[model samples]
Target chain A: MARMLSGRLPDPPAAVRRGPPWAGAFPSTLHDQRVASLLGIALGITFGTCFLTGLVSHFMQHPPNWLSWPSRPVWLYRVTQGLHVTTGLASVPLLLVKLWTVYPRLWERPPVRSVTHALERLTLVPLIAGSIFQLATGIANIAQWYRFHFFFTVTHYWVA
Target chain B: MSGDGDGDTGARADADAPAPAGAGLSVGGFALRVVLVAAGLAALGYGVDGLLTMPRATRPSNAAAWLIGGIVVHDVLLVPATMLAGFTLSRLVRAPYRAVVQGALIVSGAVALMSLPLWRGYGGSVDNPSVNPLPYGRNLAIVLGAVWAGAALLMIGRAVRARRTGPG
Candidate 1:
């Protein structure tokens, strides 16, 4: 009570009362639920696409420098590979946002009951961890620099 | 009296509503979004062009552009746009977010399968290899059919379940 009377509380800034600089950009009517749903969908598609492409590319040979040989044509492998890396890179931001939105659901309830929830939960561990690994490896591959000794190809293949 | 009881409950409920927070779009966020979108578009264009133009003879240029562009587009445009669109659609429809996400993932899978033909060997002879379009086509068909069928089934199940359960 004394603090309030003494004006110790900070005053509201003008920006707060007048509205922010980019106030109207986002639809005013939109709610958090909508945003979360969109994020989930976006992440789902991006991850799925990247995962499938990466898996396919895994079966192909790494070009020019890698030892051994591939049965498929090297050029074809490169293009698909390029696609896989590109899609994965683009998904970074979306993945981050999706994580944010679905965070609430993690605490809200279990995915389902019994085996269904168990299966879904089981996928979550590898899917999340493997996805980060894939993205990191993909970026490293693009930079034309590799440092890991575990053989990224084998790990990537199994994870995907 | 009953009138007094109603008044007390109404006052308590009003107090429970969340106080508005200042999460409306800010200048910095807007600017960031624009930059991201632009960067994505530019990268996509460069990558696609490189893919189309650079020949078997000059391997380095095409490979560089393709790699860089792919990274840019995926990180900036494709992912973000998908997220926003999916979220908005889900909210408007009031559907299960996971199911919607599953639908989107299935579609992306199909697209990836279609582009599989492009993933063959590079840098040797300029000659295009014989691609058996059948496998790719088949894979795409399977992905699409599964996603659509699953989504439809899920929606129907939800409706029936909701009816049986009545309002929560």
Candidate 2:
């Protein structure tokens, strides 16, 4: 409306053509790609450990017929379970740091430009919600803070 | 559908895209996406089916609330709080001291967060003394004291070294 009144068509910014950045488009060098990528690698290692070890521990407790629960290496369950807790604890820091880094992008303008863009944005719902849920429930469970109504084990498994 | 922690694949994909070879809609890339999406959907369906088998075992409504609450807590509380802290620190701290301060803050914040449940002894009970048996708060203080002390020493060393090799 202002441009129309002024009788001057505003030139489109180059960024208009490419689409929105997943990185927070704000000006800051600290949380750029390098830092994000490094934090990402840290998170990957910690979370990956939690997932694998948690799986082993789960299977040992609720051994299904399809898969064989390991009987040998007497310390197997102990080690896996220990690693699970350790990695999970470590992930608390890594996850929070990573979120802090990329959080600015959450407010990037024109959130979705097309069907594909919208779908991509939609995918973040699960990613964010799932990680947060896992950590919250896991922490609550470990702390024995049984304030929630749902059974932790079953819900945690499905969520995982 | 991505499960990776810090699951911002899009954030990392923006740099130097190999679009000359059609990284997005090339025949191979499209097929890969199709396979990945199919697998993700299948996993989703399987999870839903699995949940149904244990209705009483897992309270659906409450679990859903917790899931949603996690997002709320993160987006509403965590981000804003950190932004405020960062903005305040930027205004207060000088450039030369900023890195040390920031590094110290990050490490300190992470340690405190990871230690909260244990430090509070929320799970400790008369029935189980072994659960968080130690004085976590005191221990945490001791640990943080050491961390900060080390940081202080490092900063002093840097200052001293800089003085000895003055650029001016």
lDDT tens readout by residue for model 2, A46-129: 877887787777787798999886678888888988888888888887778777766655664455444444454565666667
The TM-scores, one per candidate, come to: 0.33, 0.82
Model 2 stretches astray by more than 4 angstroms = A1-27, B1-24, B165-168
Tell me how each candidate scores on DockQ against the true complex.
0.04, 0.31
Specify the CAPRI tier of model 2.
Answer: acceptable
Name the best candidate (by TM-score): 2
Predicted candidate 1 versus true structure: per-residue lDDT over A22-88, tens digit per residue: 4543342322556655755565566656655665564444444555455568586677666666767
- Residue A30, candidate 2: Cα error in Å is 2.7
Q: Which pairs in model 2 have colliding backbones?
A: none
Q: Residue-wise lDDT of candidate 1 within B66-138, one digit each (tens)?
A: 3355445544665466557756765666655456555566466435522433233211233423423235456
